[model samples]
Target: MTTGTIREIDSASVDADGMLSRTMRILGCFTADEPELSASRLGALTGLSSSTLHRILAQMLDLGLLSRTPGRRYAVGVRLWELGELSPLALRLRETALPYMTRLYEATGENVHLAVLDAPAPERATALYVGRLTGRGSIPTLSRMGGRQPLHTTGVGKALLAMQSGDWIDRFLAQPLERETMYSITEPDAIRMEIDRARARGYATTREEMTLGNVSVAAPVGSIAGLPPAALGVVTRIDGADTRRLGALVTQTAADLGRALRAL
Candidate 1:
């Protein structure tokens, strides 16, 4: 319950030892890790009677907070996502950067991405918007807007990761690094060495590490001192791309974005 608010009689929350309580308990099972649930598993986890859970589920169904998956289990709803889009920072960034990203796309005809750190869990930075060139077919990019990618084997991910601390770095390498492609880096020591290099160089690269026949150049963008909003990168086809040229361009764009973010 929110503090300092007057308690109302018959509030939406009440003693849940019965059907209503059990239903709310079941609904609470959904997390970012556990985005969906079977009614039986939910009932057991929540210690709700099967009959009560079925009834409470009907209420959630009415509210559109949960929907049936292909496997016929309940999961988070699109409506909840719609609400998150209303967040001020999220809505403002997209509006401000859309034109610039579009202009970059038009000029380069490559894949452009916008990313932001999950401030609370900075290790798992987020990709917010990915812009693809409309006219030309770019190299197949592994990154998608609104999807999560790794900070080790990806251009933007490593760039985003480079801005963080040694503690965060150590935690990241603790996991078995995923191999997106044969070129992906897996050795923890090597990745740490590269992160140090990236911090000094101010950019990162993925040469078919995330996808075959694809390569990318990435740089940090408009990151706050303690928090990086995102790393912006352009992914292009591998052939005929000059490493110096791509790195310079990405670094300049990132600097421009960093300045813009500071103003905001």
Candidate 2:
């Protein structure tokens, strides 16, 4: 079907849910690209009447979901971020892994990351970054707390995907994967091979895949017999460092974090 047709169906479905869906749509319109929006812009984007938009915006403001800026534009409030932080899986994983992540950063003087699988979607699997620790003067990274990245392009994403069932991995690999850098592996077979390597070695490594100058090593954070809730990774610049050795270190950290998570 055409994109317009799909959007119409989505709109109809949202309309079926009445005010709750409308409120959600309004909130959804604010994204990383457009963090702040005026009421008229919100009305235009959501296709809601100006009166209805204002009414909903006012309610959202009162409920602490949206805040009005000094410029009279609206942005997502800290209250909403706090509510997102309350997700049991993300919360517990972040809490359990932060100390280990910090230790990894301190030991390596790099960027340490903790990420969990985002909720399943029909199109593709993605990882939601839940925690991060950057050592002083560490290489800059695009990942941040609460950011999402594709499962096929990141070391942590590959590590998490490596632990999934074979059929699930096959289905996930069938999706169109984005090539974030020249070195990114776009072929499903290549990605599957990488997953296999991660499973055999108990860790994953990506060499300039997600970012041009960044190399990452990651390990899954869970029991050997169960699906992992998250992955732990460290990123560094590609400068002839021993990535295999780094992988081993990250694997040990992941194992420690996995034990802690199991205890929780």
Candidate 3:
């Protein structure tokens, strides 16, 4: 057996082995900006010794969780990507929302997004972006596929939040909320009112809340039976766009996507 295989066997023999956690930490070291790294760099980032890091990396390589690049740096392997594609919440939502998102982008010439709520936490709530479609002249945003954003400041986030129970909303509001931009709502009562409005209107909107000069309108991608699995939104420049009309379009698109998901 190869050294990596031997190490894997040895690690598995030990009860309550920390190898899994260390391996996860190594994988977590990579990001959108830093997709690849040398073993030494990974060791620095993860605080793992060279010998232990290399051994775990070798096992990961053997398992196809990571691959070595031409420069001997490592990156997440195609197997990881393949596994991510199998996720029901992220991949299924992306597949179901893509056609409608594209249609919304084409019709409005704006940036379209589909996001799902992260599991509820005591400290905060977040939205995980699953898919996006950028229009020809759409304003730039910090969001990326698989990236996360705070639930309070984003349109999709607010739409998803509006579907939560009142007690859950209160708990979320009790957490520390960052003011992302000048217009971001920081007061708990203000956000509570906003959530009430969104729940009442069947859609949500934010004007320069998450980012300056950007406005977004969104609706939940499911019914009020429970918290939505996803939300659909469009982002545009605040100055020239008719936000009310765009809001109507996004609400309709979200309803259509919701219906499609239900049929599945």
Highest lDDT model number: 3
Better of 2 and 3 by TM-score: 2
* Superposition TM-score, candidate 3 onto the true structure: 0.89
Candidate 3 runs further than 4 Å off: 1-15, 120-122, 223-228
How would you encode candidate 2's per-residue C-alpha lDDT over 124-215 as one tens digit per residue? Answer: 56787878998668898889776778778898999988878888877787678888889999998998899999999999889888988889
Q: Tell me how candidate 3 scores on lDDT.
A: 0.82
| TM-score result, candidate 2 | 0.90
Counted clashes in each candidate structure: 3, 0, 0
Off by over 4 Å in 2: 1-17, 223-228
lDDT of 1 at 167: 88
lDDT of 3 by residue, 1-264 (tens): 011122234344444777776776777778767888998899898898888988999999999999989899999887887887877755467777789998998898888999887753635468888888995688999898878888889999999888888888878878789999989998999998989999888889999999999999999988523334689999899998787798799999999988887777
